[model samples]
Target: MKPAELRNLGIGAVLVALAAIFPLVNDGYWLSIATTAMMYIALSTSWSLFSGPTHLIALSTAAFFGIGGYLVGTGMSDYDTSFWSMAILAPLVATAVALLIGLATLRLSGVYFVIFTLGLAEMIRNLVSWVQNNFLGSRGLYVLTDFTEAHIYWMLLGVSVVVFLFGWWINRSRLGFALKIIGNDEEVARHVGINTAWSKVILFMSTGFFAALIGAIVAPRYSYIEPNVVFSPQLSFLVVIMALLGGTHRLWGPLVGVIPFTLAWEAISVSFPNSTTLFLGLSFLIIVYVLPDGFTGLLEKFTRRAAK
Candidate 1:
């Protein structure tokens, strides 16, 4: 493996090792935080699949994410489906939604793409709210399942690791190189005969797969699914923050992003509460202007400079 790839693997190994004892080392406080952090990490990695690889800043990430949770909760409880079985169903459902979304919005570009995605997410949220109110008899439908926290926790961690590796694998593939080109210059990519339209489809669908998967597994963890929470812009912000903080369009960008960013959210929410958005926005602005490589990029640059 190249140094970057090896570094990624090494970090994954350390995280896995730490998670092995996370449940044992303390009370629910640490484990719960770790679990939450890891979920965001997984979600962030999912968004990176499209945004980093294929040059799409999809704001409709929460649509499929919430859909995942609804699939598991509604399916397992209302339809009498199994947990593991629904996990499989969740991604497929999300993929279908993503394909439809891609077809609808693929022709849109830049800020227009972002706006269309947001519109789609809002539409889904409102539609789900109606279903919850009229069809599901309100209270957002509680999912009765036997899956334990540890079961879900371990599964999330495994998936987070897998998602991280998935991003790295994309970095190494010809498709990934193609994505880089498209992201850099769609004109050049088009000149080279790259299928920009289809790539965006693949990109968005892949993102939906994981985002929906995380949303699905986590919904059961809550045992209740709400339309607003499921299709939250906060979730979108968290994913974007992870990618930006880590360094966008790179393998480890989102990986570098989740740790400090998650901790910051937890800490500030406890203290400042309402002002957290302001703080987050300021940090993001600074990062974009001053440290475009993200925190990880900065470290790598310093390491190189120090070596010289």
Candidate 2:
């Protein structure tokens, strides 16, 4: 393995060790906070896996997430399936949906791509809402909530680690090279014999599968699943902001962005309550102007200057 890979393994080992022990000393409140942070990390990194390399702006995070949650919720309620069974099934469903959507929309780029993705998510959300209200009853579905907070925390941690490792693997693989080429110039990539569309479709489906898996496993932590809550646009936007704030070009950028911002989000939400969204919006705008490449890029610049 390369030195960078070794370093990443060492760092990941330390983080896994620390996360494993966190529930031992932390209270339920802290454990919940940590779990939320881990969930955001997983979501953002999974999102970065596709959007970072391809430069496609997707707002379907909540769509996949909500679909996974609903799959679990409905499966358990309608068929009495176990959590593990639903967890395995949700990702498959998400992958199918992503394949269809990616194939349809991969041809669109730039702002048009963004709008279509966002529109697709909203359409799904509304369809889900209508179904629940008409057939499934207006009330939200209840989840099996027997698992302890520690178990949920560990699950979240595991998902985060898996997502992170996948990002690292892709960034170092030949697929990453192809993505960079496509991102730079899709026409050139095609001229050079790269199958850009299929590459994007594969990535889109892969990321969707993981994002759905995370949501599937995490769904049971909450006692209830509602379309409006799970499919909120804000949830999608949060992942985008997290990835952007961390730096999209590097595998580790989302992790770096998620940690501090998750903590700050918790604090800001508590302090401002009503105005928390406003503050977050302003913060994102400021970061775009000040650190266009994100915190990871800034750190790289600082390290180079220090070395000089």
Candidate that scores best on TM-score? 2
Candidate 1 residue-wise lDDT, 92-131, digit = tens: 9999988987887785676667778767767888887787
**Winner by lDDT:** 2
**Worst-scoring 10-residue span by lDDT in model 2:** 107-116
**Which residues of candidate 2, in runs, are more than 4 Å off?**
none
What stretches of model 1 exceed 4 Å from their correct place? 1-11, 136-140
TM-score of model 2 relative to the true fold?
0.95
Cα RMSD to native, each candidate? 2.3, 1.5
Q: What TM-scores do the predictions have?
A: 0.90, 0.95
Tens-digit lDDT track of model 2 for 148-188: 87887888888888887777777778787889899898999
Residue 133, candidate 2: C-alpha displacement in angstroms:
2.6
Q: How many backbone clashes does candidate 2 have?
A: 0
In model 1, pairs of residues that clash are 68-216, 69-216
Relative to the true structure, candidate 2 has a C-alpha RMSD (angstroms) of: 1.5
